[model samples]
Target: MSVLSVFVPVLAASPAAVLVQATEPPAATPVQAPSTKTDKATDETPVIVVTARKSSVTNKIDRRVYDVAARPDAAFSSANDVLARIPSVTVDPRGRIALRGNSQVKVLVDGVEARPGVLNNLQASDIDHIEVMTNPSAQFSSDGSGGIINLVLKKKRKDGLNGIWSVRGDDDGRYSANANVSYKTGRWTANASVGVNRELTVTRTDGRQHWQTTSGLETTTGAGRSTTSPRSSYESASIAYDLSPKDRLQLSGNHYRPRALSKDAGTVLITDLSGVLDDHAESTVNPDRGEGGEITAHYTHTGAIKDEHFDLDITYGSSQSQESSTHRLSHTVPSQADQAYTYLNNGRDSSLTIKGDYERPFGTSRLTAGFQAEQNGSDARSRSENIAAIVPGEADIDTAFSYSRQNLAGYVTWQTPLGRWVVMPGLRIEADTWDAGAVKRNDLRFLPSLNMNRDLSDTTKLVASYSHRTQRPDVFQLNPRRIYWSRLYAYEGNPNLVSQDTDSYEIGYEFADKGFSSNGSLYYRVNKNPQTDTRRVTADQVVIQTVVNADQSRAAGLELTAKGKLMKKLDYSLNLNLFDSEVAGMVGGETLRRQNVTYSGNAIIDYKPRPKDWIQLTLSGEGRGVALQGYKTGYYRLDMTYRHKLTAKWTASVRAFDLLNTSKQTDIFVTPEGDSRTVSRKERPAIMIGIARSFGNTGQ
Candidate 1:
């Protein structure tokens, strides 16, 4: 009897009958006679097979990887949009990114340091995945005290030609287009891409300040509206060649240009305990532009030994920016003379990096080592003039500044397995030199890291890690020249600022089954001599903002993530983070301390009604955040996208951003002598529609 026939009868029979039949022997069947002559031919049938899709998120012992290619909205999303959807990552209206309430985080592209504003110019479609390492190994640079984020670019290894073209536009006067093409033949591969984006934004701001004066209490209120239009374009090209079966070489270059124009108008009211002192009207206009470019060359060699390789890379980059502004202020209540101001500023910066790495395996152990050398230089010039002679000695001022730095680092790590546990230990040493006009300094530091992983079963694991990292002061923080914002406000950098150091530790548990995965982690971090911005009033009653080193700070947090399929046609991903933070520092000879508990989370739900249609919804938000002398209110955003495949080579999508129109930020500062509050709001809800076409093989 066939296996199916025997099991079917056993499953359908009663328990008593099945038990009796199982103990008895069956009778044999009679065989038929052999068939004659020729038998009729039969037609063949085709067979089909289905496989499960890969998960959008993967948790490793040391890091978390997010697959950008697996998301249906990647084709129409920007780098900022993608990052906002990730756990522990937050992006503000100004495009500033923070990780776990810390702004001192480093970002890299394909294992290399990227230039500032690079993320704003990148499209999500150009990236294959993103890696977040809260406690990085010593092999990586210790530039960021919080953590590191790496963007891995897509690679085309299959032969022949491939290309993609797309165009998108929104109802709020924004538009973008991108084109990419790649070709491979023999041992050579080449790729090129070009893109452009244009945006028009409007914003409104309101502020109120109160202070205790010698005579009585003084108050100031202001309201302002501004509009900005920015245009950006980027182009990149790369080529790779294989010299032999074990050797390869690659060369790549990219360039970007950005330009913007802005206008602002506002009204200010000043009052004492008695009555209104003055009513002032002000207006300003600004124009800004910048361009940057970089080139890189890389080489690799493979050894005969398993998992043995050597790699080398060299990169050089340069950038320049210029801005000019004009402002006018008038006292409407007193009918005083009008005051006018004009300012011009320009800056240029360049950087060079060289790196080499080697890895080898010995039996069940692996060793890795790397070295890096970096050099950076910058120059800035500014000119300010008060046409109305309102500020006396500050009428006409000219300033010039230059800064440079050099760094050399080396690191080594060894990984070994014992029973069901794996451990890796690493150390790095760095020597740095800084020069800024009259200021000079030299320092040496040693950093260490340890990571461990234990396998509990086929589908579960435990991991723990510890790392020591540092954050150096940037050029803007080291410059001593004053940059004026208005007659009543200015900003300056500290020449004696020092680097910040941090120690971080984390423990996590992860489990993965056929169609589900979850990860939870607990972490703590301590920072020494952290840098923070402070505000003070000068003898002339002008507000000055500057950076200073704080005594210390501490943070502890728990992070959780889960992703799986709810049914055959629905899937979802969720992330939640809860944290507590404490900061203590001295400002203007006053000791200040602040503490708070906060939380952040995001959720993504995807629904597939048909084979060629998809709908996705994403919700993300954060709780109140604490600052050195102030606090910032939290905000939430909701987004949705619908995508449909029109044909094998064409696709269309529509996306809505900030659907609830609740994206706003408020900041409050309290001090012994005064208090202030400010609110800022950007654009409202927006809808965008896009179309994309694919040509040639994508190698899927």
Candidate 2:
């Protein structure tokens, strides 16, 4: 009994211990054979015990899986909230995701690439598990260079009806509601879910920039504050049917609608070498509205041969958005310089993908092959006008831009086991065509990967992998239109921007001991033609920010995560990532270099004094980081949550977010000619209370 108590905590720490791994469903039979039993058994009763997986964390050869669907103290309301708990992953104040200190991560829903903002609309309750693939295999797409995060949705697997309803509210005028229902009967299953939310946020930005020109130096200082109110709703439905004992078909659709309004006011001061200041006061109001929808279908067939399979997947998605901003400025130095401007922009995007794969067993080895064809297109139109002209070159401007891309890819992989090790090797071939206005590009690329896993003992394992991937230039990065945000700020896309290619390598170790589980990895990445955001100052001291292809860069990092029970009533988990990065680039015939060493980590501790009550505290933060031409400062946050069960079907919870309200960012840019510094801060401290209920079949 003493040994069992110590061992139990180790096996249960990983989220994989909570959710059963996916497996093929048992073949249905019209009738069952009678069971054989002794006559004496009929006079006695039978006893049975059932066990279910609990919320924990675990790792595979290529990824780490986190299962939080059943954790009452997880405090996971949205997809973003779930991501915060993952190791080496961070969600910024603006909801942007960064993995391993890089922002090029890709997010997918059930192995499919979803549209932007899709994750924000999903309820965490609907997610079965999250897989963080630091080094993906050939079966995955090669679109992103950083990494991949996959969200797996829950499905109805039982032969009954089940549903959940939850509502939440906070002191900052934010409220949300979600409902999910599913039913399974015979060989068919159906599910539907809906979520609605309204949120209000306040933010502030204050910064100063100093430019060193040939003559001397020029400085620009500004500070601004804004309030945003956004409302969004989402709906999804899915149906699955078993065509036969070895075949199945599934279909699903999702729709999301969101609208937001923002108002901001600020003051800017520009000073020359003589210390003479030109002061300006500015205010703006912006309104944005958008809607997106996606439809997907999947078909699977299992051959008579064991471990043989074929599958087909198809998807179509579309979105449309419109945004407009009105700005007013007042100048103190030159009263006649005061002016007002209005800008409007509208955009539409659509994409289609068709993929199919086949897998078969060959003796003691397995081989899989797949092909994918995809097309994406986008169009945007912008109009900028001077409401009250107080300067030259302020005439009305109207422009339109459009871009399209077609991609075809094929990949093959073979996996075989030898002794106590497994080896996999894969290759992918891709052909791409891109078109924007009168510009066109065509490229053929080959990507290769190798992965190996070895078991050292019953309680330890090792894995090593390498892969080559690419990040294609975005449509907006290829557009050549000049978009003016204000009189002193404007940007123009570069038609010469090219795709960034990356080669990544990782070595990992997994270990387990009494009441504890841990995993660690060391990774290195080399990038070519790295795309970067560059800022150029004009003669009038106007900063133009644009995307450009840099020379080269490289990054090396180490990541570690661990979870276990400290006591019978206390559980704890920790995740950490440390990395060193360097970038080299040439601008205007001058060589530039920037290097940095940064780190980030997250820790959580939970205590349960009673069977029905629990409390948890989470600490997460980041360290200083370097960019292409500059560096950024980081901040930390503390959060807490408490939960109590009111009844068998009802649960109550409370949460405090950003308890210290110290989440902020500061950045510094360096150049041979001059340097700039910018600081942005936001205080987000709020408390919330929520309730959840589950009815129908209680067993999962």
State every prediction's TM-score relative to the real structure. 0.91, 0.91
For candidate 1, the per-residue lDDT at 126 reads: 78
What overall lDDT goes with each candidate model?
Answer: 0.82, 0.81
Task: Please list all clashing residue pairs in model 2, or write none if there are none.
Answer: 14-56, 14-57, 15-56, 15-57, 18-53, 18-54
- Model 2, span 468-504: residue lDDT tens: 9988888888877666666566787888888899999
Judged by whole-model lDDT over C-alpha atoms, candidate 1 comes out at: 0.82
Q: Which candidate wins on lDDT?
A: 1
RMSD of each: 7.7, 5.5
Q: In angstroms, how far off is 5's CA in candidate 1?
A: 32
Which candidate ranks first by TM-score, i.e. highest?
1
Model 1: per-residue Cα lDDT over 520-621, one tens digit each: 889999999999887776544456778999999889999888888999899888888899998899987899999999987888888999989999888887
